[model samples]
Target: MDTYSTATLYINGKWVEADRGASFEVTDPSSGQVIGVAADAGTAETERAIAAASDAFPNWRAQNAYTRAAALLRMHELMLERSEDLALLMSLEQGKPLRAARNEIRYAADFLIWFAEEAKRIYGSTIPSSRTNQRLTVLRQPIGVVAGITPWNYPVSMITRKVAPAIAAGCSIVVKPAEQTPLCARAVFDIFDEADLPPGVVNLITTSRPSEVGDAFLRSRAIRKLTFTGSTAVGKMLASRASESMKRVSLELGGHAPFIVFDDADVEHAAKGAALAKYLNTGQACISPNRIYVQRGSIGRFVNVLTDRARRLRPGSGVDESSTIGPLIDMTAVTKMEQQVADAVGKGAQVAIGGERLREDGLDGGNFFAPTVLTGVSPAMSIYNEETFGPIAPVIAFDTEDEVVAMANDTEYGLASYVYTKDLARAVRVSEALRFGIVGINDINPTAAAAPFGGLGESGVGREGGAQGIDEYLDVKLVAHVLGDAVD
Candidate 1:
């Protein structure tokens, strides 16, 4: 792979070093080597970026929807033109397989395309007035400058999901990309610059000082909205702080998704789906299945097929062509996987296949864990109670439909859940019963550029993908017109 470097803050359409010349090294989690350095932004830079966005908001909001849509379309073209490079860069920094990285680039670019069309579709409505001499109308307008805080898991996609909609809605934004993956954010901004977006319309600030920057965002009155994608703890803290200013907020937080396989489901098909849902991106996604429930009658066959699929996964560096699963983000992730497995085993959960980290081959220096399947996982085990953000799938057996649905909805975090069944009535019943923001009926991949992606409960608030996505960056105003005013 070629060495890539993008170590600067992008503010007001220019790439500049941090104010104090502070920098932080970015390491490849797969190889434990410093890939590049990113500018370490502070409170001052964050404030400046916020100010820039605020200054540019009115003109951006004043532009016709078609003009903004054209810019987004150009960005979409640039992203696709550099798809391979973006994929390689993401793979090098974030440690996902090159193939998966390529897919993410496509997914990221699709957001720009989707929102480009959606920009022109921001429709308003006219309502009948109660009084005879009055008319009523509803208008959707830009919510002004926005602040986006994205995570490292899906670096490219997360940024586009937030920024594309904001831009499409005619709002200027200041983005704070995750410290672990600032290059991807910088790369996206490069596309924006090449697309000829106006100065101050989009700003990027790479920072090691998250809280300082976040506090600056909260304190800035010019920022009207704040959107975030990260852990639940961090989301809650930011939400609490933003409350002081009553800022509009949207968050996509942690999830403990449940994958259910009923007896009526095709055992082989269910197992394949389970493997894909559980181990994609090495199970680092927020929507990854944490607890898998199989009907008592199909548990044996499901376990056999699932274990075979797990054993076939080739864990290696993300850039390696033959690798199927890549390393976890860092040592902390490895430690969490270790602790979860130890707790499950201590509580009498039996490991069906792999139960340890993969220290063999060239994976010792990086954070690599074996794809594991635990058969006897129960409520007593910590794996059942906590979110396992690694490649560990714990299978729990249930006999009744009510039991499975209850078990699936037991968690406080309700982001996503999956149900597999051939019976139409049962599928509908179970799908309606699951208390999640998104439900997959015999489908592991339910999210797309046109769907509403968000969560219920502690999983966070607001939607990110569909028509509702643009609404997050907009404000509704009801206008009442009198006959006398119309005459004048």
Candidate 2:
């Protein structure tokens, strides 16, 4: 509770109280309890944060990549040094297990480390000119003043994912984290000050009114790029707003990824992969497989194995050592899952294992939903089309490869898809055929700091992470100059 009290807006490199001086409480989803208060920002404060980021852009961009890299290295070290404390804080507010939070911190820190090195390698190309005397040098320059709009599902890693690459590419940013999880964002920003990040290089604001903050970013010419991670509907709205100014937008939006298991694959490994893909983050992840497609021959065995694994999980507070399944971020999330599950069941889906909300003595009033498995889910059900961003795995049976591939590509989202098979040729065929931006063949974890991550179609625009990640924050400039005449 004391930790949330200390949480405040970070602007121009200072911890600030909201101009209106009003604050809101951040709740612990596991206990349905208020953990801490955060300063509630309005339009004025949001504009100030933007102004600060815009003001700091030139100086931060002027620094050499080596200097920037060195600062990032310091930040990386601090994150590692304070990993335990940060993870516990995250677990309290985020409702994820302490161990999971710890792993997220490590994963988040790896971005800092990877991007720190990448900072020094913003390479440009020298192109040959048709005219011998003319010289052409293609340069990559930072797209100034980025705005990061992140979701609550991954408080630390998501911020690091956006901020690290932007910083590495020499772009200053103002971030607006989800209202539910501002404490984790503030904790990460605390390290920025200690790492000696210049004032205005990074700014954070929390507001109940997201529209005000979004309008400020969209309308301001100073904010060159906007990066968001959330639902597809919101992403579409943001993109529409950004288009008015022709502001660059990078959106990591919603997904209903398909986990396709073929008859020829190893059933146990495929089941394990399904659990890893669908149940991590309690299936709040956008890339979590919303629908599982198994060939008729494999469907029954796969369900048995997956349910056996899911039954091992206990939905409880993150404080419990044996608790692997934590509460959803809020009641809203729990309610949504309830609605989706109901819709599926109403339409003939059968629950294989857990289904009802968990309400044991210790779990009462908390946002805990049993990790569920549903069979006989068809395309007619809403769960088949909509992303059930919960701990429910609905297995849909299919008969043929062509039919399954068509079913997998049926959704508007093309974010991520997982395929499990032993045949190298089949893996290649499916991987090439999937319309998604990311396809995991025989593996559930397809994302890394060194790999480009994002999706096609409604899943959002642009890529984040790897060398391509920094590219989004940069603009390509072609320099053409007349050189001395070449000797014949």
Candidate 3:
């Protein structure tokens, strides 16, 4: 794969240098090597990007739904054509297994495909008027310019999830991707440029000074909507800032998801689901299973199977096809994982599989933590309360349905929850009782491009997919018609 070294910023449909002529190195997490150089921006550059989006908003939003859908469909096709290159680029910069990278590319493209169709389906309803000669109809209009902030993890997917809907709804946007993985953002913009997207329709700015950029986004009246995906703390900060201007805000923040296994669940199937949910992306995902609760009768067997499955996973560089577990994003992630494991062990939790980091082979210089399974983890332990964000599974035992439901819903984060059971009534009951925005009944992957994804409570506000996803970038306007005369 060719390195995107010397990648420049895309603003107003043209590639330009940063005002300060600054650049940053994008590192490959798996090999601890510099992969590419990306343009760096500050507050001034961010403001310029915002200005560009604002300038293009009027004409871009004036296009009909079919025209917007056609452009989105072209981008979607281009994305699929470059799938292989994009996947390798993702693996090089983001450090996930190659298969995972490919899957993410496909998933990202699916957003474009899904939203291309949804663009033409933004329908409004008519309200009945009291007078026969009067008419009332609702209108959905683009909310002008949107400012988006995407995280490093799942770079391609995160950007696509935001940009696809924004474009589909005929809104121009300025995107600020995480500084650690700006190359992926540049690559996506390259595809957008190839699709001949209008100048200023989409702008990219990479900067380390996120605070200054965020302030610029908030200060600009042209930016009517702000969308962010990151930690709950940052999400709260952005929400607070946007509140002053009364701007629309959509946040997909942190999560501490729960996985519950009933006594009647097939132990093998449950184990497989747990490994898939908790170990993908080294469990760095926001919706990763943070806690697993099994019925007392099945706890022993569940732990045994999970430990064996986790032990069999090969931890190595994401470039390797055979390696299922890849390195964490950085040393800070490794250090945090170690502290959580140590805290759990000190609280009487037993390490059932791995409890150490892998410094073997060529991995000594990289950030790799062994797949771990802990038993006897209790609410008293820190691991039980905090998200591990690594390939560590902490198992807790529960006696009945009510007890497990209470245990699962005890967290302030309510993003996603999983329930494994053979009983239809229990599945429905548990699904309804769970406070999460997304619930999986005997399924690990509840997320789909066609489904609405978001969370409740401190997990942040608003929906990000399905029909509601585009709504975040749009506003409702009521149009009334008076047949006879204008009323004062």
Candidate 4:
């Protein structure tokens, strides 16, 4: 994984550096060390990428679905063939554990495989006509060139989630990956290149100047669609900009998901699920549980088990096979965790486990924080209202089912929520009551390639997976025909 030499911009089927030779240093969050240099593309490169996508769109859309599906399937195969390398690269840049990184690679590649089959199934329908000589038909067509802005967290999967569906729907795309993990994006584009995708059908530009690229995408009439995954604020800004040009837009934004544990739930099992949900990817995920609610009767047992699990987690460099928890993406994430914990404690919350940074055990150089659990967390605390995108879980107790449901749905975000209960009737009732796009009833990980994944409200619009994913890149056309006397 020699990222120093490997990181470059992929445009129009060529690997190149910035036009002005400008570049930025990429650091490994685990060690706070410069791992590589990535091309810092400006507005000029962005426009060029947009032009390339526009130029490639017509021929790409004209190709039959089978041709497109073949290329995507090839990408899937190449990704799997090089999964280990991909996983290592991601672990280095993104700061997730090696095992987690390996799992992410598989999940990311699954998007291409899933959409490859989905490409062949973009069906249109025929409508019955009122007159004997009249006919009506409907068609689903590609929306043309797309501009994609992916986030740092889950860099590989975020790119595939957008690019796979766009390509599967016959649209060409230009992607601007997060500055922190551009090497992973470059690696993905390498697979695309080896798959023999047509030049300009897929392009990548690594840049620190995200605003410049975003503005370029907004101003370009050539880019007909915009898809972004990041903060709610940024998503809103991008959506507003896209709306000014009437460009089609889809956003997967921030979330403050709630994890609920009922008395009916197996406390030990629920505790295990909570630990995974709260700490996956070091809680940087948009769908990670921000708030944990336990029934008053189960709170004592649940907290004890959860705290034991947190205490047992080993935090270090992601490359360490023995490490279960990894460093935060940067110092900012570490600072946020500190601030949140401090705020909660000042508001009378008690730290049941860890509550400070990890400065020992060779973790001083990186952005590392202890896995923390806060009890007596109240609505008055900042952690209760804000999305704590770190390894800190705030537990709040509730008296009844309705009370828990109300507490879970008290946020503006509506992304992912979790409810643990063995009562079948109770699971259905609470699941339906929670105002989120995806709910895991007695299950922690609910996302899959074959299921629609997205958020509601400020959590953002549109979906990214399953059969409906391709639809985000397509447009519908209805044709009505009137026939004269038969020529035969």
What is candidate 2's lDDT per residue for 315-338, written digit by digit as tens?
788766678988988888888888
Span of ten consecutive residues with least summed lDDT in model 1: 1-10
Better of 1 and 4 by lDDT: 1
Best by lDDT: 1
Per-model TM-score versus the true fold: 0.98, 0.98, 0.98, 0.98
Stronger candidate by TM-score (2 vs 3) = 3
Please report how far candidate 1 places residue 473 from its true position, in Å. Answer: 0.7
Candidate 1 differs from the real structure by a C-alpha RMSD in angstroms, to one decimal, of 1.5
Candidate 1: where is the Cα deviation over 4 Å? Answer: 1-6, 485-488
| Candidate 2 residue spans exceeding 4 A from truth | 484-488
As a TM-score, model 2 comes out at: 0.98
The per-prediction tally of clashing pairs is: 0, 0, 0, 0
- Model 4's alpha-carbon lDDT is 0.92
Once fitted onto the true fold, the runs of candidate 4 whose alpha carbons sit more than 4 angstroms away are 1-7, 485-488
